[model samples]
Target: MDRWAWANGLLDMAETLVIQQRGVRLYDGDDKTKFDSGTLLLTTHRLLWRNQKTSDCCISLPLWQIVFFEEQAAGIGKSAKIIIHLQVAAPNKESGPYQSSKYSFIKLSFREHGQIEFYRRLAEELSQKRWERISVPQPVPAGRSQPGRVKAVGIVGIERKLAEKRKETDKNISEAFEDLSKLMNKAKEMVDLSKSIANKIKEKQGDISEDETIRFKSYLLSMGIADPVTRETHGSGTHYHMQLAKQLVTMLHAPLEEQGGMMALTEVYCLTNRARGMELLSPEDLVNACKMFEALKLPMRLRVFDSGVMVVQLQSHNEDEMIASALETVSERGFLSSEEYAKLVGISVLLAKERLLLAEKFGHLCRDDSVESLRFYPNLFLTQD
Candidate 1:
């Protein structure tokens, strides 16, 4: 808690907002604190929290202070949380809610349920080290000239410097894309350039593009796989698939979390290929790679449903939790068709039906196949007996 600093909620130069969540509570170590029910904002440089009622009361913690973090699943009567372990507080740390803490960590309880996506984005920011890239100008002493430095003093000088930089950037871009061979050779540089362009567009326009398809394509391009495992790179056969499976697990973790911990194999194929850019993966190769997910004991597994719908889901996805949620929804609504439940839950009709079938299999719900469509009701047999 001492690591936090009081702030006026103003972003630093070059800093940008990544994500935000409402109804979040900050925990001082494991104990409760007065900083309850606030909005948590994740930026490139720091994690800012402001009271929902009193917006003026805001505090921030630098991203560089974080050592690591993990998600704590929601439990009975408790909200989900992100446990952020921190390094020792700096000697010159700014004032915060607490002077000292027993534990070297803090928790952010997500009451409104956005921990998964927040965690994913947080991981990305940490891996990127965006804070280190931010070069804040240091104040110089009153009448001192810094050695080996020439500042752009006037408008013409500034314009000349900007023009030179733009010319160099344009030259680099042209050279990188002069031919297909050059583009393939400079793939890593291209990815970095793509991300920079996307970030600039997002900063100015709030998104890379207005069109949905274009926006999605831009997103995929921004998340390019710098070192994708390919047959040519790793050689063919079982060894190649094994390496491919490991890479897929790392690449798909965030996407799976965003998709409610499960995604259809076909959707994964499209996303993977798009992210890979030129190197596309065939359906057969994708299936072969996914089959090794279980054998390798990765965090995700490939499951082929009875209906032949294959999906990749996190191992932490609990069947009991899904069943309980479905049961509670059905109990509240009295009865729900698959389509109705899908609309309510914001999931596909196929997944909704699968959940309903699983609940029925567990005897928590009973299905009624009527003329209109199949509907499910709370299992009265379990309640009556």
Candidate 2:
């Protein structure tokens, strides 16, 4: 259901009621003896009959199915009635030779004196629908002409159409860029500044590679944010922080998965702030926003080790699992260096060393720091051997 239509007590937003009358009688095709007493609603889209006792007991007759509406005066002391001709069934095949036309009828009687008004409104709305259908333009084949229809004149003869289309496209582009033209100009200036710096560095150092210069230019190009959400646009400091937290969580999913369900706070800050562009958040703001995640029951949390290195880690992350993985990796090759552990655990060398030291502390692994190269071995393997 459409929210607006639900709020308005309607089936769809396109439906509009022309008549809502209580104490109405509805009779189906050729069934004068059997009638329903209910409230009748006639809309531009459909006719609805709602039973007086049951809320969900209602029948619908779409306007498209209705073929005719004519007034019929009931006798005195009774209500006014209108007969609706409906195209519900196909022509009967077993009928007589002249019985090609087939239809059904519904009779509605209203106790109030607005039957004439209802008939006029229904007629007007149906006429408007017909007019709208007739006014729509139909496609014409190329190089073909009809007596009463417009024809497509092909590319050579449609200069006016091409100009109009081009004008419309340009207008849309202009509207979209009207607010960001200044920022775009500043971005161009930044690119020029980057080129000048690159040239100066090459002249002085003679060691700056072309790849580095290209990377610098690309970074300069990525600095300007096409769309940034700030307090000014999102309203209130609290709302801005909440929105930023949601964006951070969404962006961290891939990197966290790649980094074994955790990432250094420093890396997340740099990446998220760079993506945010001019509306970068402070470290404190990021921290506060992350604090709200616990209350919001998000899947991740902020973790600070004894050495004061903060990280974003999934709540499901387990140190025991990390240690088990480290033990398996070291036992597989008989030993693992810091670089090998980093590759095995899918984390940076620094983080990998931290986990190795922690595992050594817990007696899960033993480190051999020799002059040649430092390596780790599973404690069980070392003990068994």
Candidate 3:
């Protein structure tokens, strides 16, 4: 069992584990208060550091409270320390000039053996938790003002341009001019434009610092399935698998776009499981669910290569387009390797090999196998020098 399972055993309430590392010690980052030994756990919603000796003294940090993290290298017999910066919100009724910004910090130490991995995983979980907290809506307390929602700063310019164009046309004619469908389409366009601006901002900010890159990754991961169908909700039956398959297909749109419209089944499994959280489905279950896609007439299909490597691709994904592109890539060189094809195709080398084999099966390409390496070329090139 994982350290997270051990930690969950200690908890009285149910929680979803994100990441966990053992043999951790905590200290107050501000005063360097007396150290406490424990195991560190990151859950879907909070950071937990539990004292191995005393259960009552465990410390919890919510995602909304985190601001940043800093690390310090360690010497012999000492583990590396991670200083987590947090901005705890002050009570609304207790406002005064004397009240500080509510900044706090905590330090955690772990063995030097895999300190880098520990740090990376912690940062990843922290970033993802923060984004999830931001993206998901939360209930407001009674009599408290709701927090302001995020809006694309570029939307103002877009609205201004639309208004100017509207003024140039007939201004007197105004009676819900657009039908419901047209209005919905216009709203979708505005939403797409806003998303584009947000992505551009994220890209620019990510280039500024390594911290921003981590933050960007977290934001991307937080775009998970908001309403994942599970055995509990949909029951264990064909109907459940059918619903799960449909949801999976819908959720795959963004990932498919990122991977150039095709993705390895292994990658799909990992992403789906991560999105499922504590209600993770087994690999067999996922495969079975995917198998129903064809029967359900979803836009995606599961294809198994001769090598037994499986992939999920859009029904509209054209093999001829892929073959044409691959041929173009190797036209001048007259040869291509899986590595080169992978970079061109935005897939793993193993999956690229399968693609090459598929093209060869279609008689679009020919392969040259040697003791040193294997290469592929357009089938027509076989007759040339």
Candidate 4:
């Protein structure tokens, strides 16, 4: 879950708060610096405080030990203070349709320094524990060193153990897919954890067994899996949801331009999604993406594949010149094959022929065919010289 972090100045960085500034600390959660007037945010994960007049840096606290103390409330005015302890909620990252949960002031003081003998109630007031302590559970000593504890270990997981997992019948495939889906959510975390562990191993290379470290790193690396269940930011789905796809749409332009005036729709999906690494798109997702792309009036088309190789491409729409150039490149080669012509400009024969026809209309190339071969050459009649 993402932690809600905010500062008084920039709303752009704010994300993951059950309520705006609700769980966000007004004191820096990350810094040791003392401040008289500037706002600081403190949290279990990161202390954040902002410097206003100059280059702003937010101080962050990374551990949960920092917390509220009764002594810290001394000399602060009542009107300026709103001291309330809430049952903290989940962190979310999105714009609207927010949530509201009930909270009560555990201790209320009329003024900061006033000793009016006011009340402070926690567990009984909310019917919930006000203070939570996080401590490691005490370990229980083993009764007798068991055979299992002293025994030499064999392979923990045998290949045969997962044979059933891999050998599911076609009917069970759907059910298997559900299990795969569950694994998908945790998959990304495993990948990230591996990187951390690998870095640790590298940091203490000589101190650790080299063979053991290498084997561990390889095993961890092999466990990488893409987790799509993660919400865009908050726990379910979010505002940055379409961000990577949007970026892919933008990145598709250069390759599209070189693909003659049109490309197969499927090709665009492969190329665009590959550029995104693990964030592959479904065909329908790719299509919808292209529709959004077309709305921008980009010189590209979402084309169908009569042959099942659909693509998205920019309208090199200057087909005539492209064909003319291809024919001219061939004519100068004195018998250059079609394969050679296609390679230099990065296109297929089908697209090249389309360009050639356009050039033919412009009188740049003349097609001649024999039983053995067919080819095009520059039109000497239209010679510039």
Candidate 5:
């Protein structure tokens, strides 16, 4: 397309790869271009197409030039395509395959069937507009100040500079959340800026703050999702919940692994909302989305205990494994209460009780009710006899 520019296939500073696919063809509007087969790369700033055979030949179009895009489904004898509508070619656009064009759009034909995922990622990138964030300056080199910039000399000067920086950060935070509509528009920028500040503080002082809540919040902000699935993007009803379930599975995978392979739904809701930044999810919506985890065949599923507590746990967190582990623990201690087991295993008392109860149900353990505490003991009838 005329909007494209000749590129050397190297990414610009701060630009990062989003996704890539092979067997893609470029079209100048509805007409096919010479680039019939190649690898298409989606980066934070550009859409680059590299020749499949001649690696040196490459072209890129800045994402800023894109007005919008839509998918054209695969049909009889045709591959699926993404039609990218573009703004008018800028006068300073670099030399490309075409010096001029009759149309204001281009098409990318995906022969190998990756259009669905490509479209999804592309939509997310556009929504987040990471290219805008790329302009943020990297840390200055040690012992160097920008030309014409004053360098702080003594402790007093350094303290003053720190105070000014803190004031600026506070101001930015205040402006970002002054209005609901404004907060939504600036959420990604604010999150990224806050994370950068937190990282700098950690690198210099070894922690963001002394307060435990602030430290935990900074950790949550560090895990902020770039683009969360919402009805606005995926549509409402079953489709939205299905997409939401998939996104939750991807986002919670690491957190779940760290939390002994399971987390209470309430904890999940808090973490998910915090990681989502301004896009807070409702409890009802979260429950609805989690209900589809099994239907969608995700790595995790929602479970409701007999006592009405709900949890999201990895599929690999098998009941048999839990029961066996609990039985072993009870056997080692001779008898154990849920509270004691919870402390030993570093899990919630409720979950510990559930595990012990499950082992009892399987005849691997026996329960005793006493004035002091209820405890579980290995079933002597089955084990000793």
Candidate 6:
């Protein structure tokens, strides 16, 4: 889990194991912080306390431990349906205790809450805690005879020979470093050589970098799904697997432009690598891909937001594409809020904000505070310059 730990366990939440259907709303008859009536979805993995109109965050619950809750729900209905009422109860928790009410608690006393059924469905799902422990089935079958799984036609695979070559190269490089260290600091010229190489490459350097990037991108595209990093090894043996893991991530960057000129670099990494079948990369490679794109003038960037989430931006992505989608979004909904824009773009709020900011600068969009940094239909922002 070193890969997981370094990436802030970004993958942990990636597969929450808990699932939901139909959102719920939370509202207060009169908003008060301490005493509220909003409903929360309690689960073996998390306490998905939520408001329907907005996304919900599932707070985690410990397994096999006793927890005291201010309240809990027994069942749901409008006319004072059954409630667990943990207001004065000590909750029992366990890791898949193979029984009901063995995991965690949810409190429903917040008066600001909207409805209770949302939490009710949650209770029903959690009551079957053993089911939640089961892994989601593979989307497609690998082949030949599997029950409860659709036969999947061939997952793509990357070249192991190419991978091994890369690995051997890496190993050689590592050994070279060790040997060089004994040579009394002869490595000082590495920086000068790299700069000299950069200078010598000049304009062509960008072209070559870009060309190679595109080449690899095409390679990744034609590439079948990557082999699991565990193909031979037990647990991802080294950093080389990490790079192979990032291939899908670098590959998907192009598609992001249409959404909003951006994507979460971390998310892109997760999704792309996931598509590659659980091979993964270090955050450093993710950063490197962003930098490579930036160096190539690909309108892509590694944005460090005030919120501190990192994202990849694609400036070259057509505004017409986003605006085209935006037109549909607004047409469907009357006006696109920041929340709606993100939904339309299929990206995070941080990326949505960057797209809005870029649009405002480019005259392709307009924003009002009511829209909360969201923009619509362009005006001539370019006229000032």
Candidate 4 per-residue lDDT over residues 1-385, each given as its tens digit = 1222333333222111111111122322222113323333322123344543443544322223222423233353322232434334344422211133233112222221121111122112122221122111222458845343333234533343244335434435877799999899799889999899789968987887778868976764454333321121221112222443355455666556556556656566566555545645567656665665455555565655343445566655664556656776877775444555667777775555555555666677777777766677778787766
lDDT of each: 0.85, 0.67, 0.68, 0.44, 0.85, 0.45
lDDT of 4 at 237: 18
Worst 10 residues of 2 by lDDT: 1-10
Model 4: ten consecutive residues of lowest lDDT: 14-23
Can you tell me which runs of candidate 6 are displaced by over 4 Å? 1-225, 228-246, 249-261, 276-279, 294-310, 313-316, 319-334, 345-347, 370-385
List, residue by residue over 1-385, the lDDT tens digit for candidate 5.
8898788998865577888888899999999999999999999888999998999999999888889999998899998899999999889667888999999999999886567778999998898787775532435879976897565569986587577557656865876667766767688798999999888767767544458657766776686999998654554467778988999998899878877788889889998998898878989999999999988888999999887889999998877877888888888989999999999998878878887887888899998999999999989899665
Q: State the local distance difference test value for candidate 5.
A: 0.85
Best by TM-score: 3
Assess the local accuracy of residue 353 in candidate 2 as a C-alpha lDDT between 0 and 100: 77
Which sequence of candidate numbers ranks them by TM-score, best first? 3, 5, 1, 2, 4, 6
For each of the candidates, give the backbone clash count: 0, 0, 0, 26, 0, 23
Report lDDT (Cα) of residue 180, candidate 1. Answer: 65
Which pairs of residues have clashing backbones in candidate 5? Answer: none
Model 4 score (lDDT): 0.44
Better of 4 and 6 by lDDT: 6
RMSD in Å for candidate 1, one decimal?
20.2
For each candidate in turn, give its C-alpha RMSD to the true structure in angstroms.
20.2, 20.8, 19.7, 23.9, 17.3, 24.2
- By summed lDDT, the worst window of 10 consecutive residues in model 1 runs over 130-139
Q: Write the per-residue lDDT of candidate 1 for residues 1-385, one digit (tens) a residue.
A: 8899888898865577998888899998899889999889999889999998987999999999999998888799998899999999988787887778789999999887667768888998898776665533445789997798665568986686577557656865876667767667799798999999888767777443468657776776687898787654554557778999999999999878876788878889988988787878989989999999999999999998777888898999887988999999999999999999989988778888888998998899998998999999999988996
Clashing pairs in 1: none
Query: Which 10-residue window in model 6 sums to the lowest lDDT?
Result: 1-10
